[model samples]
Target: MQLTVFPAPTSPTANLDHGHDHGGCRTKALQTAEQLCNNRGVRLTPMRRQVLELIWESHRAIKAYDLLDRIKPTTGTAKPATVYRALDFLLEQGLIHKVESLNAFIGCSFSDHQHQQLLLTCIRCLEVEERPAAGVMEAIDRELEQAAFIIHHKAIEIHGICIRCAKHPPITATI
Candidate 1:
């Protein structure tokens, strides 16, 4: 098989790191979702909104079944399909991101804007933080271009101890 290379883009412009009001993140995300859906002529259905809220309940990535379990109590009987559909809608609207490796979902930090960034998962805390490294994305673009390849969807996941976790000792299981 032959290899290919591509040309990349520019420098790093933003950092989605932690250290702010998490509630603010959720509020902004919901507001942004509302505005974007309205602007795009799409409806921010109740189910989708609920899913977005649950995902934004924390910075950690959560799985589909977990979402279903959480919603069933509130909805009185949430089907797998309903939760999945809501997740699909949120993902399509860029309100949330699917952590491919973990098969879980996390609210996107750059939801208001359009751009894919790095997902840093804290092994100890299980919190996933978004970091927009334009420099790194540029390099990926360059590599893809050199190979004459078209991009479909992309996500870079890095798993390790986050700053908070790194500062503290590892979390041990109760059992």
Candidate 2:
């Protein structure tokens, strides 16, 4: 499936809503995960589903520790290992991407694994937006090919302030 990439708003005051359906987006991600697991003959356990849901519930990237903390209240016995294992599974299945700089995980907006993606991270809000980076990948591949190198896994992260955060800076406290 092809995912449409939305360009950044040209004006600061633009509504910025490109017809995104939040609830539907979450549901679609879950459904895509389930379908992927089924196709691979792997089971998406209840714990995995719960973890995926938690990650999709927020647009911001989430650390594994934060996931464990959130799960603890519901499971009453959640552990870091449990969350990590779930994250590993999701990562292996390409259902999520790990942001190395932030040490956090974000649900993959695209289901296809044929291409690499570039993540735009907001330094202030810690929110992440994914955009297809086919051109970037192609350039990397060309350079790697010249060097006789191969890429097994790839994710590029660009740090910047999102338009929303740029337009309205976060409030600061005065001592």
Candidate 3:
């Protein structure tokens, strides 16, 4: 078997790392966005940045309707298609990922390149956790080998009650 070698671009943001630091996260994401758009000769419009920022603030999968709600007043009663187009651009740039199960999206926690999004949804608090599935990804590679399948982007999502919810049950049974 032979391996392919790809040349690297001259953008600095391509080396950013993904972690739980929001300060670093936002700064890095913005810088990365600029680098990516500039490298591709595309404009990352202000409105697009605003929409992406809202999604990042939540750190969870957000529905299109939800995004529309947040962007409406500022964007002057935004239409669904408009928001969808912005989302499409973001996804195309690998800046975000759509959660298939929830019909929602979250900011791509990875910085340098588009990384596989792995979500851990809390059944009780409805909080979504994003992390790199290094170990699980390796396991999937082995499993796929056993089945003679080639896996592309690794998506391993698990839904369950979080520790806080497990210890303290909600009174109203909210999601």
Candidate 4:
């Protein structure tokens, strides 16, 4: 028998269904990352910056190899290890998040500060929206305390149909 465990459900509704200014969001995230890296005395190398840019290009979770392939056109002879190293650096600096469930990465806007969050992935569009679920995280912490458990890491990924998709699904052509 196999056992599968899923994270607890998050907030009931989607908050990013409306028009999203991805241009502004991308700029802000890159600026914040640069500032954080500068403050921490860390180098946001060109490769790392590129990786972060790719992650922020869409709301969807992206795998490392996908990053590698996407980067190859601009960066010649890019290797998996090189991308992984950049990913490690980004993860260490909290500039990006690794969505374990999807085995992918996503940029974090609140990387400058420490906070618990949950990712709401749209099943239809495959877009991932990050939401700060303080209440849910607090409840989890309480449960952990009661269980006398120590948390080394924390992240919650909830998969469902986003409001945008639910409200206005893509029109399919008749066969």
What are the lDDT scores of the predictions, listed in order? 0.81, 0.80, 0.71, 0.81
TM-score of each candidate structure, all chains considered together: 0.84, 0.82, 0.73, 0.85
Model 3, 1-175: lDDT tens digits are 4443222221222221122345556667778888988999987898788778777765556788888988888969699998998899998888888777788888887746537757888755555677777787778779899999977665567788666556664444223
> Could you say which candidate leads in TM-score?
4
Candidate 4 per-residue C-alpha lDDT over 44-154 given as tens digits, one digit per residue, 9 for 90 to 100: 999999999888886777899998988899988999998999999999998888888999988886887865588888877677888887889889999999999999998
Per-candidate clashes come to 10, 0, 0, 0
Instruction: Return the candidate ranking by TM-score, descending.
Output: 4, 1, 2, 3
Off by over 4 Å in 3: 1-24, 167-175
TM-score of 4: 0.85
Worst 10 residues of 3 by lDDT: 9-18
- Which pairs clash inside model 4? none
**Cα-lDDT of candidate 2:** 0.80
Ranking by lDDT: 1, 4, 2, 3
Q: Which 10-residue window in model 2 sums to the lowest lDDT?
A: 9-18
State the displacement of the C-alpha of residue 62, model 1, in Å, after optimal TM-score superposition: 0.9
- Please estimate how well model 4 matches the true structure, expressed as its whole-model Cα lDDT: 0.81
Candidate 3 TM-score versus the reference = 0.73
Better model by TM-score: candidate 1 vs candidate 3: 1
Q: Which regions of candidate 2 fall more than 4 Å away from where they truly are?
A: 1-21, 113-115, 169-175
